[model samples]
Target: MANSNDSWFQTTAAREIHLEQLKQAERFNGRAAMLGIVIGIITEGLTGAGIAHQIGLGPLVDGYAACRTQFLPFCF
Candidate 1:
Protein backbone atom coordinates (compact mmCIF):
# COMPACT_ATOMS: atom_id res chain seq x y z
CA MET A 1 0.00 0.00 0.00
CA ALA A 2 1.14 3.54 -0.74
CA ASN A 3 2.07 5.71 2.18
CA SER A 4 -0.63 8.26 3.01
CA ASN A 5 2.04 10.94 3.36
CA ASP A 6 3.42 10.44 -0.18
CA SER A 7 3.80 13.61 -2.29
CA TRP A 8 0.90 14.42 -4.63
CA PHE A 9 3.20 14.66 -7.70
CA GLN A 10 3.90 10.89 -7.43
CA THR A 11 0.42 10.08 -8.87
CA THR A 12 -1.35 11.12 -12.07
CA ALA A 13 -4.69 11.88 -10.38
CA ALA A 14 -3.03 13.96 -7.69
CA ARG A 15 -1.00 15.82 -10.32
CA GLU A 16 -4.17 16.66 -12.26
CA ILE A 17 -5.91 17.87 -9.12
CA HIS A 18 -2.94 20.04 -8.23
CA LEU A 19 -2.81 21.47 -11.76
CA GLU A 20 -6.52 22.28 -11.69
CA GLN A 21 -6.09 24.08 -8.36
CA LEU A 22 -3.16 26.03 -9.78
CA LYS A 23 -5.25 27.06 -12.79
CA GLN A 24 -8.06 28.28 -10.57
CA ALA A 25 -5.61 30.25 -8.39
CA GLU A 26 -4.01 31.80 -11.48
CA ARG A 27 -7.40 32.88 -12.81
CA PHE A 28 -8.30 34.48 -9.49
CA ASN A 29 -4.94 36.31 -9.27
CA GLY A 30 -5.31 37.67 -12.81
CA ARG A 31 -8.80 38.93 -12.10
CA ALA A 32 -7.66 40.61 -8.90
CA ALA A 33 -4.77 42.38 -10.71
CA MET A 34 -7.11 43.64 -13.44
CA LEU A 35 -9.58 44.89 -10.87
CA GLY A 36 -6.82 46.77 -8.99
CA ILE A 37 -5.65 48.45 -12.21
CA VAL A 38 -9.18 49.49 -13.10
CA ILE A 39 -9.77 50.88 -9.62
CA GLY A 40 -6.48 52.81 -9.67
CA ILE A 41 -7.29 54.37 -13.05
CA ILE A 42 -10.81 55.35 -12.01
CA THR A 43 -9.56 56.83 -8.73
CA GLU A 44 -6.87 58.82 -10.52
CA GLY A 45 -9.43 60.19 -12.95
CA LEU A 46 -11.76 61.21 -10.12
CA THR A 47 -9.19 62.61 -7.64
CA GLY A 48 -6.35 63.78 -9.92
CA ALA A 49 -3.90 61.97 -7.62
CA GLY A 50 -1.69 59.14 -8.85
CA ILE A 51 -1.82 55.75 -7.18
CA ALA A 52 1.10 56.55 -4.86
CA HIS A 53 -0.51 59.78 -3.65
CA GLN A 54 -3.87 58.04 -3.35
CA ILE A 55 -2.25 55.49 -1.04
CA GLY A 56 -0.65 58.35 1.03
CA LEU A 57 3.08 57.93 0.30
CA GLY A 58 3.20 61.51 -0.93
CA PRO A 59 2.88 63.09 2.51
CA LEU A 60 5.33 60.63 4.02
CA VAL A 61 7.95 61.54 1.43
CA ASP A 62 7.31 65.23 2.03
CA GLY A 63 7.68 64.72 5.77
CA TYR A 64 10.99 62.95 5.30
CA ALA A 65 12.26 65.87 3.30
CA ALA A 66 11.07 68.33 5.89
CA CYS A 67 12.74 66.38 8.68
CA ARG A 68 16.02 66.25 6.78
CA THR A 69 16.01 70.01 6.34
CA GLN A 70 14.48 71.20 9.66
CA PHE A 71 15.17 68.31 12.10
CA LEU A 72 11.56 67.87 13.15
CA PRO A 73 10.85 65.75 16.27
CA PHE A 74 8.19 63.73 14.40
CA CYS A 75 10.91 62.34 12.17
CA PHE A 76 12.10 60.16 15.07
Candidate 2:
Protein backbone atom coordinates (compact mmCIF):
# COMPACT_ATOMS: atom_id res chain seq x y z
CA MET A 1 0.00 0.00 0.00
CA ALA A 2 1.23 3.53 -0.73
CA ASN A 3 1.76 6.10 2.01
CA SER A 4 -1.14 8.56 2.37
CA ASN A 5 1.21 11.61 2.29
CA ASP A 6 2.94 10.40 -0.88
CA SER A 7 -0.39 9.81 -2.60
CA TRP A 8 -1.61 13.30 -1.67
CA PHE A 9 1.56 14.93 -2.98
CA GLN A 10 1.36 13.08 -6.30
CA THR A 11 -2.26 14.11 -6.82
CA THR A 12 -1.48 17.75 -6.02
CA ALA A 13 1.44 17.80 -8.46
CA ALA A 14 -0.65 16.33 -11.27
CA ARG A 15 -3.39 18.87 -10.65
CA GLU A 16 -0.92 21.76 -10.84
CA ILE A 17 0.49 20.49 -14.16
CA HIS A 18 -3.01 20.17 -15.65
CA LEU A 19 -3.89 23.69 -14.48
CA GLU A 20 -0.87 25.13 -16.27
CA GLN A 21 -1.77 23.32 -19.47
CA LEU A 22 -5.32 24.59 -19.30
CA LYS A 23 -4.13 28.19 -18.92
CA GLN A 24 -1.84 27.88 -21.95
CA ALA A 25 -4.61 26.39 -24.10
CA GLU A 26 -7.01 29.18 -23.14
CA ARG A 27 -4.47 31.85 -24.11
CA PHE A 28 -3.86 30.28 -27.51
CA ASN A 29 -7.58 29.91 -28.25
CA GLY A 30 -8.25 33.54 -27.34
CA ARG A 31 -5.50 34.81 -29.66
CA ALA A 32 -6.74 32.66 -32.54
CA ALA A 33 -10.32 33.88 -32.08
CA MET A 34 -9.22 37.52 -32.15
CA LEU A 35 -7.24 36.93 -35.36
CA GLY A 36 -10.20 35.28 -37.04
CA ILE A 37 -12.48 38.16 -36.11
CA VAL A 38 -10.01 40.70 -37.52
CA ILE A 39 -9.72 38.78 -40.77
CA GLY A 40 -13.50 38.50 -41.08
CA ILE A 41 -13.94 42.23 -40.56
CA ILE A 42 -11.30 43.05 -43.19
CA THR A 43 -12.86 40.68 -45.71
CA GLU A 44 -16.29 42.17 -45.15
CA GLY A 45 -14.96 45.68 -45.69
CA LEU A 46 -13.19 44.71 -48.94
CA THR A 47 -16.15 42.76 -50.41
CA GLY A 48 -19.13 44.66 -48.94
CA ALA A 49 -20.63 41.30 -47.94
CA GLY A 50 -21.21 39.88 -44.47
CA ILE A 51 -19.56 36.80 -43.07
CA ALA A 52 -22.64 34.72 -43.90
CA HIS A 53 -22.71 35.98 -47.49
CA GLN A 54 -19.00 35.33 -47.87
CA ILE A 55 -19.60 31.72 -46.83
CA GLY A 56 -22.52 31.40 -49.35
CA LEU A 57 -25.34 31.19 -46.79
CA GLY A 58 -27.20 34.13 -48.30
CA PRO A 59 -28.39 32.17 -51.33
CA LEU A 60 -29.38 29.15 -49.28
CA VAL A 61 -31.40 31.28 -46.88
CA ASP A 62 -33.13 33.13 -49.71
CA GLY A 63 -34.03 29.89 -51.43
CA TYR A 64 -35.47 28.47 -48.24
CA ALA A 65 -37.61 31.56 -47.70
CA ALA A 66 -38.89 31.47 -51.29
CA CYS A 67 -39.75 27.81 -51.03
CA ARG A 68 -41.70 28.36 -47.83
CA THR A 69 -43.67 31.32 -49.11
CA GLN A 70 -44.32 30.18 -52.73
CA PHE A 71 -44.42 26.44 -52.17
CA LEU A 72 -41.89 25.84 -54.91
CA PRO A 73 -41.68 22.30 -56.28
CA PHE A 74 -37.91 22.19 -56.04
CA CYS A 75 -35.60 24.46 -54.09
CA PHE A 76 -31.90 23.98 -53.59
Candidate 2: lDDT of 24? 100
Output the worst ten-in-a-row residue range by lDDT, candidate 2.
65-74
Question: Residue 51 of model 2: what lDDT?
Answer: 76
Go through the candidates in order and give the clash count of each: 0, 0
Model 2 residue 44 CA deviation in Å: 0.5
- What's the CA RMSD for each of the models? 5.9, 5.1
lDDT accuracy of residue 4 in candidate 1: 56
Top of the candidates by lDDT: 2
> Model 1, range 1-76, lDDT digits (tens) per residue?
3575454436867788899999999999999999998999999999898887888766556687557766466773
Off by over 4 Å in 2: 60-76
Against the reference, the lDDT scores of all candidates come to 0.80, 0.85
Question: What TM-score do all the candidates reach, one by one?
Answer: 0.62, 0.69
Instruction: Please write out the lDDT profile of model 2 over residues 1-76, one tens digit for every residue.
Output: 5699899999999999999999999999999999988998999999898877777776556688557666566776
